[model samples]
Target: MTINLTMALVLAVLYAVGFYLLMQRSLMRILLGIVILGHGSNLLLQTAGGPPARAPMLTSARPEEMADPLPQAMALTAIVITFALTTFLLALAYRSWTLLGHDEVRDDVEDRRIQRLERRLAESEEDAAEELEKEATQ
Candidate 1:
């Protein structure tokens, strides 16, 4: 198999692992999964463009021996974007942990239940306010 194809297969495996980790409730695992997915995407992009022969600089080189320069450029862009996103995710995770006193995300079922209860409470409060308004009007 070609180098690009091998790299693509590896990237796919990495993405699967990342997806699995992301499904976990732990904030750290989620962050790590995101980073892994980012790296996998970057690798896929690089592999798609094929391997680079030499730098894109204007140097005295044979035309036939040179590889595609686009992949290198794409890799650089992906690296920068990945770095920024990773940093932002880490910061957000840290802030969430500090504020919530726990890194693990609450279970989806529990969260939905709490949300429903909160909505009911809010509706009751609103009804009471409306009744008070009506009494005042009367």
Candidate 2:
């Protein structure tokens, strides 16, 4: 289905902001991002169904005039999924606050170690290449 320019722009903005928020370290910001993304998704699904028409259950209208029920059902499913995930994130944020007194996410020690190892390996490779170049020059 075709969407108006305004609606398309709004969807783009919602997705962009949502992704930006998701990249933040704050748990609350991430939760908000998820909600915004969910909204964008629902809007996209609804747009795919074309314009709204008479209810599918009502037989008073022709089949072509009846609204497609799939999009509505999918939107409802998305809402429930979003709600469940939001609740889960809220609980995690609450638990994190109780333990750390802050909602910021921290890097894990294992990840740091892996980064250091990768850095060292890259440095070593660079050094080896430089040594080979020097030998060739000599």
Candidate 3:
């Protein structure tokens, strides 16, 4: 109904989608989620100023009808910061994909550790077998 309420609902939906995407394994999806979250936050900031009662910034604007400029400034700053952060994160994701052959970071730390331990155990067993063979020969 009201502009503020409408914006709040839109922001809530966007945030929900962003959170869902953030939980995904794909780097691209996560980055997109971050972007969506940023936009939602910016919209929320703009909405906080209460629907722009009058023209934003002008000398002839009445004191009682003046819209808050602080939110606009904040939105602009947030946009720039989000843009830079998005670029950096996307580049990191690309590099990670290239180096690791996948976008998702390995989630199974225990499995990787167990595999390493197995490799070490196998190597030790081979060494023991070789030593036994040498002793028999002697």
Candidate 4:
């Protein structure tokens, strides 16, 4: 895999900023973060395939010198997928703004309730495990 220092640095920055934005509460910022993260991953996939070269046509170049097309194809697919996701996010943001007059996402009550239940379940499991261990020892 050929990795240019500049490209790697750029990718790193993109990922860092993307994650930072993703952690924020704003819908538009989250969408931007997802797009940035997608772009960074796409760059990573492209860089993993090594330096660019002529197309992998048999007659046009030697077998050893031909560039692999797999990475580019993968990057293209990711691009399309990311573009679709971005569009979806955009639509969601627009709809949310129209309905609520703002696009900030508040915590879901059901999500919090589920989290509380999960916490209790985990605690009960731990207690049960402890009881089983104590029984085995006694």
Best by TM-score: 2
**TM-score, structure 4 vs. true:** 0.81
Tell me which residue pairs clash in candidate 2: none
lDDT of candidate 4 over 39-107, digit per residue (tens): 998989888878878889999999889988988999999999999999999999999999999999999
Candidates 1 and 3, the one with greater lDDT: 3
Comparing 2 with 4 on TM-score, the higher-scoring candidate is 2
Give the TM-scores of the predictions, in the order they appear: 0.64, 0.86, 0.69, 0.81
Ranking by TM-score: 2, 4, 3, 1
Residue 98's lDDT within candidate 2 is 100
RMSD of 3: 10.6
Per-residue lDDT tens digits for candidate 2, residues 58-134, read: 65888889999999999999999999999999999999999999999999999999999999999999999999999
Counting clashing residue pairs in each candidate, in order, gives: 0, 0, 0, 0
- The candidate maximizing lDDT is 2
Q: Give the lowest summed-lDDT range of ten residues in model 2.
A: 55-64
Which digits, one per residue and each the tens of the lDDT, describe model 1 over residues 69-100?
77667878888887887898788789888999
List residue ranges in candidate 1 displaced over 4 A. 1-5, 57-59, 107-138
Please list the residue runs of candidate 3 whose C-alpha ends up more than 4 Å from where it truly belongs after superposition: 1-3, 55-59, 108-138
